[model samples]
Target: MLRFIKFAKDALLAFPLTLIFLPFSRFFSFLYYYNKLVIWIWKNKGDVTYHDFYSPFRDYKKRYALYENILQEQKLKEESICYLEFGVASGASFKWWLEHNTNIDSHFYGFDTFEGLPEKWGSFDKGAMSYKIPEIDDSRAKFFKGLFQETLNPFIQSHEVNITSSARRIFHMDADLYSATIFSLSQLFPYLKKGDLIMFDEFSVAMHEFKAFDEFVSNFYIKLRPIAAVNNFYQICFIVE
Candidate 1:
């Protein structure tokens, strides 16, 4: 009789709890389906899938291959190019560019906090990737220390004349956040020209770089064609049209 009474009491308590949560469950179900439809439409509207731009490669870094291919195809090394890199962690990629692009007149600029990310990212907390700004011995490369918002505008204003006159501009976006990526794009929008290339390091992160690029392009009515993409989609290169 005691066990039966306990069971009856538990059932009575669960009834009110279920009733209270039922509305939330239904609301979430609706939202889930709505988002699915939106994503479907988004995918159908020119977003390239892995199957659409995959090439067989063995034992090679696809991102570097794409960058080199684009550089060679555009003959950027033969022209006066202003290369800008966002999120210059440890200056490894920046140094690589300095060594490879042998053009005497080419200039490279790198932007970073040097204190690392301002906020938390996936599996990484704030201040992650922090490093001391390395001394780049090359005269062609310059590093700007601070947040992008703090550094980019002042630099752009100061060099507006030179920026306008540059023959070619290449943007290397290693920024891993949506805000940083989109902000950089907006700040540089006035300077972006046809035939320029923008390479994204974390393009496959849907909520960050990919979303930022999509919204920025749509907002600015900027047309872009995918020149190359890694098989895993971690990196992608696009030519602005």
Candidate 2:
């Protein structure tokens, strides 16, 4: 009985020690995995990568949040114009928007390379073009192919300047690279109105996206305030007046 008591006491004392070291152990494991992931990314930096435009396996919570935002926005207005998305992975978001956007006149305008991202995008890294885009069509949905700036400029200039311009926009930027994001932002800057929303897929990434957002804001002298930020730190939805 005494031996059992001593053993229990010793075990109880060691519990705190285990608790103290567990966090460090987990952190070290995270560091190891992070370093490995970086090495893998570096090794396959320019290699052809897959782009689904909309992967069904995306984080469900993120998708749900997107739907809730759209639904809430629709309830506030009858004819809320269009929901624009830059990287139409497999048209997942487009489908979500179409289903939830019961507002009769609302549309979804998705722009993509259709051939995946460019071979060499600016300086930081390259995007993958391994996945093929699937076919989707809706009367209200307009799909454009090619580089974002190349395709968007003419479309915006043509549709946005009319006296009866119903050309409002809510853009989602998910290109995940500095050059693509900046280029898209520059082209889209002119069309943005007071309540227009911009959701950046790669916002606040330590070195890649935060740098791009900062540079664009500074260079353009724009004030884009965050409206909603996801807990995962993967995306931020903003509005610019």
Best by TM-score: 1
The 10-residue segment of model 1 with minimum total lDDT is 50-59
Q: Please report, in order, the local distance difference test score of every candidate based on alpha carbons.
A: 0.77, 0.63
How well is each residue in 1-241 modelled by candidate 1, as lDDT tens digits?
9999998789978766567677688567546544543463345436543222334553235556666666677787567788899999898777767777877888889999999999887888999999898797778888899999999999999878756775588899997987899999998898888888898888766667777887788899998776656644557777788
Candidate 1 collision pairs: none
What TM-score should be assigned to candidate 2? Answer: 0.65
Model 1 local distance difference test score: 0.77
lDDT of 2 at 40: 33
Candidate 2 C-alpha lDDT tens digits along 115-155: 76675543533455434564666677777777886887776
Candidate 2 weakest ten by summed lDDT: 45-54
